[model samples]
Target: MTSLTLALDAMGGDHGPLVTVPAALQALKSNPSLKIILIGNQADIDPLISHADSTVLNRIERIHTTEIVTMGDRPVHALRTRKNSSMRLALEQVRDGKAAACISAGNTGALMAMSKVLLKTLPGIDRPALVSCLPTVSGKPVYLLDLGANVACDSETLFQFAVMGSVLCEAINKNPTPKVALLNVGIEEIKGNDQVQQAGQILQHTEQLNYIGFVEGDEIYTGNVDVIVCDGFVGNITLKTSEGIAKLLVHQLKRGLNSGFFVRFLSKLISPRIQAVLSKMNPDHYNGASLIGLRGIVVKSHGNADEAAYLQAINLAATEAKRRLPEMINDRLESILLDINS
Candidate 1:
């Protein structure tokens, strides 16, 4: 197998090299064919490398950058001022074909802005959407798009999201004809605003989309749909809300289990099963969100992600790079456009 190189913004996340470097090393352990280009201040990154096994060290390289894009930095500001920052350098690696993909846990706004400018959008794509995998009840994951890329979208944009999202699911999840849905207030025909309803009309008419009608927010976890499309504002809110609720439930369940001696004993008896379920629901396992529609693959890790979560993001980038996801998306997009024109 050919080796895959990923460019990582070592200074992007809250913990910078402290978290990203360790994660990159851990990811390298699992994926033998993977190599990483770590972009950040050498003073900080060199020490982390010094601690890694020498064999693992051979697969890693470092690029030095003095500037850092903080979580509080404005997207526009980062674009103009931080041209040589770790984030921009990492993206440049992908754009220049030195790396197959780029991963950052920096400011979402800045990453989106920089990636769009550097990588550009695929032909026939108006704007890139933030896509991510979410675990569903059927044990199959649902791909959600426009997680926060475009805050407001038109009917046409929603249609594009569905197409891009479907292609993504097919490429990564190996679902050839992933069921697609428009997230809305209800399942009724007249449920959503003009954009959503109009988008639904287009989807229903489009060929080979497998477009299901409107789906409620509650249906997101039901595994009833393989792909859920929505404007970024709604999608972002929905993702964050779901994550919060999942954490809360886990916390409450632990409290209940520790309430008394008998309860604790029973918890131990069922701990294995409970842990399996909890592991499936853990957000860390799904930390990478793809900025799809761009010419190259760029994954956004959570700003506050730990080593484990960051490792998941790196693995995601490696998987997509190996799959050549950007090319797959472009090809599928052309087909979808041709169908629309026909």
Candidate 2:
């Protein structure tokens, strides 16, 4: 059995326990060996568990909390005022080693705030990272770091993100020595502004990673880069823009197909391919973001997430628990520092 039990925030997100509870049940079906400690009112959670299949619901246990962190509440206040809120209590479990990781879709700001205070960053890592996977052209995906949790990041933070992200690719995605790249406006080392240029130069010289040269913004989906590093400001903007573009393309494609009978015929001909493409585009497939470099695994889901989104987050938490993600990254970083000193 996996030694790590995942702490689930049963009262987070726009839908609260109603959305998260079903996702937890779905996760139990898919991942039998995984154990879950649900953080919410025992009455609320117990009813949902009873509603699930007898065999599967047996895997989950309620931790019993009564308060919740709403999406609009101040994160700091939620932690202090609602000490028993599902979000805060779940993380506290992870911090106390009662759980291996914590998963939430609650007040995003609160989750970020509470995680930093509870989990703390790993040694030598400047700041923790919020990483997500974006689709690449090669049918594979690229891991993008610092998507939105923190706005400002330095070279040292980016470096640690690289180390942690590389480990994520290896452990979660099962890629050994994943290829990493620093995101920049241009491919040339001399072309980007101060931060990009400096990170590129530093990454180019980094012996600890299989660091590739600069990756252009357009090349992110080429499947050419396994890991893309950048500051949170840039990364968040890029993530939103990419999502916007995806939506725009889908809308335009639909409009163009419905324009006329002839075009509609072509669309029907390509309908099978189109359906396949749309299926691949569902955001639920990559719904979880790792709050990497923290002491415990903390998976972040979309605030307005549906059951599928929470299901993805639960599966991600499951995977991280199985991998014991932090220990692996810490061991790798320690080895690198030791090698550098020697």
Candidate 3:
């Protein structure tokens, strides 16, 4: 693999340097070709990596910044006032081609706002969508998009999202013709809002995409579809709700197993298998959400992510950087738009 550098907002998340520093160290160890630029206060981050060997230390660089975009900070406020903040510096690395991608566990709104302003959206894409991978029942990864990036989307925006998601699925999942679906209230044609129906019609007519019909909320993890497109309002709720349900199921199973001595004895034998299944459904594995269709790759890690979870986010940025996902999406959209115009 070729060497690539990633810019990290080291002080962006809840745990700040404590989580990001350790995660960067782990990522560097796992991927020898990877270099990370930690953007944050030098004093806070130096202590964490000070003891590392020269080989590791050589690959890591730090950019000092004293400002932070807090979780409560508004997007406009951060953009206008926090130009020198770690988050902004991290994105600037990508904007200036100093880094292949930027990953942050910072304020979602601020990150999105700064990214769009600094990196800009790709041509043919009106807005960038927040897309993430989710483990499916078939053990494949399903891509879901618009996860709180744009709460309201028209049909044309939804079509662009499908195009971006489809390209992403093909690039990351290596599916030649990924099955794309629109998330709707029901499978029937008469069931959804006008935007969904119109978008479905547009997708169905597009020969370039393998656009399937509507899918309900329950089908997200069915693995029948490779990309599921929805507005941010619904997508965010579905993602959070699915994560909550997975955690609840694991908790309930453990509680039930411990309720009786006989069950507990059987749990000793069955616990490993159950845990293996639960681990696949763990949200940490899916912590990074890509803000797709931007000129530069930007991944938003869960604000509360721990070291391991944040590492997953870094890994995600690495993969997308290697794949040149934004270029692929732009090419695909251009081809599709040209075909439609013709």
Predicted structure 3: lDDT = 0.94
**Tens-place lDDT digits, model 1, residues 239-314:** 9999899899999999989888999999999999999999878887889999999999999999888999999899
Single out the weakest 10-residue window by summed lDDT for candidate 1. 277-286
User: Local error of candidate 3 at 228, Å?
Assistant: 0.3
Q: CA RMSD for every model?
A: 1.8, 2.0, 1.4
**TM-score of model 2 relative to the true fold?**
0.93
Estimate the TM-score of every prediction: 0.94, 0.93, 0.96
Error of 2 at 244 (Å): 0.7
Candidate 3 has a TM-score of 0.96
Q: Please give the range of 10 consecutive residues that has the lowest summed lDDT in model 3.
A: 277-286
lDDT tens per residue, model 2, 1-342? 544478999988788788888888877777767678889988777777776777777778788878888777886787678777899899998999888889998777788888988889888776788999877779888999989777887776777788888989999889887999888878776776676676666666668789987888898889988999888999999988877888899899888898899999888998899978976786666798889988889999887889988888988887888888999999999987776667
lDDT of 1: 0.93
Q: Pick the winner on lDDT between candidates 2 and 3.
A: 3
Give the C-alpha miss distance for residue 214 in model 2, angstroms: 0.9
lDDT of 3 by residue, 1-342 (tens): 679999999998889999999999999998899999999999999999999888888999899999989889899999999999999999999999999999999999999999999999999899999999988888888999989999999999999999999999998878999999999999999989999999999998999999989999989988889999999999999988988887888888888899889999999898889888787677876899999989999999988898999999999899999999999999999999999889
Please give the range of 10 consecutive residues that has the lowest summed lDDT in model 2. Answer: 196-205
